[model samples]
Target: MLIFFKERLALLSVPKTGSTAYFKSLRDRADIVVSGPPDLKHAPVRRFDRFFQNIFLKMYDTELEVMAVVREPLDWLGSWYRYRSRPELLGHEKATHDLSFDAFVQGYLRTPRPAFADVGSQSEFFRTRSNGRGATHVFRYDNQQAILDFLQDRLDTEINLTRENVSPKRPMDIAPQTERRFRKIHAAEFDLYDRAR
Candidate 1:
């Protein structure tokens, strides 16, 4: 997560959404950057509301507008699948080296997901708190220019990004029936991505 205090903006690091690259690009300019201990680094909307919002309001008299990027549901899952397939994770319980994309996604749909498919839901991550606070600005992963434009204009500074933490390139094909089931069961993810600018 990157916090630009002066701009009253907090960028939530949604997993597999190129947030690492944004952290790399903006860390120097951000007043506070949480880039370690994955849990904190990937702090979601509710976590921010619970842990940091009050501090900002009391100390700085600022109500930070949260921003985040969300990727298409299937593409986001594919990234996770490919990432865990890396050779270094071959012996890890969470590795996807032995699973096909379809199997991985099917596992993800299980009530108690298998370790390899246990990635949390993006919709859940950005869900609004009881107070109706959640990400105020959202960008689609495919729309890099729009994200950049918004950041540059908001921060009043030049922004440059370099790809970081990219997952391996692989052809990820899910059976049509499985894809249908996934979309039906995880419709919230699609809805959230569609609403992103």
Candidate 2:
């Protein structure tokens, strides 16, 4: 999808989703490289319309299979905390300053501020079909291997992926507080995410 817009293929990165490592290894393989060794703070995926158009349609639309990897909401939040909190890794002055796992979860609940794409829910992003080419696939981070195989078939490349964005923070099984916050903040996304779960 991003490739259609910039005329180059790029890995639409999402925060704390092991995308950093995934992109690092795949950077050279990708035709239009958005992920690089230098490490960009606000990469292209950080933009709102990451997948602006699909060249096939010659319209400003996202392409099908413009999928994203979604983690268990709570686990996702925990991993995000580890990534952003590490100022050195993320190269942010205060990436995690004054930010708590609970607070961030609350924020996501309040507004599922997707680092990439416009809407929240994974289904929303995928369901949103565009005459111009929109995302059609969504891979769960828990099932990355299958997603990678799918991508391999699509891109016609042998991808040997390694490295992950694992955080030391213990996973919180029941995020009641987080759930409550999301219920209020990301009402629609919460509904969708729950339904999917």
After TM-score superposition, the amount by which residue 105's alpha carbon in candidate 2 deviates from its true location, in angstroms, is 2.9
**What does the lDDT come to for candidate 2?**
0.49
Quantify how close model 1 is to the true structure by its C-alpha RMSD in Å: 0.9
Query: Taking the tens digit of each residue's C-alpha lDDT, what string does model 2 give over 1-197?
Result: 12422333334554545666666666665545454332332232223234333332346343423445555555655665555555464545435445566655655544435342112344343344333243244456677777678667766767777776555453344358667765565555444345431
Model 2, residue 61: C-alpha shift (Å): 12
Best-fitting candidate, measured by TM-score? 1
State the local distance difference test value for candidate 1: 0.92
Per-residue error for 147 in candidate 2, Å, reads 1.1
lDDT of each: 0.92, 0.49
The lowest-lDDT stretch of 10 consecutive residues in candidate 2 is 39-48
The digit string of per-residue lDDT tens for model 1 on 1-197 reads 99998899999999999998888989999999898798999998999988888798888777999999999999999999999988899899999988899999999999899899999999999987898578999999999999999999999999888978878777798999999999999999999999999
lDDT winner: 1
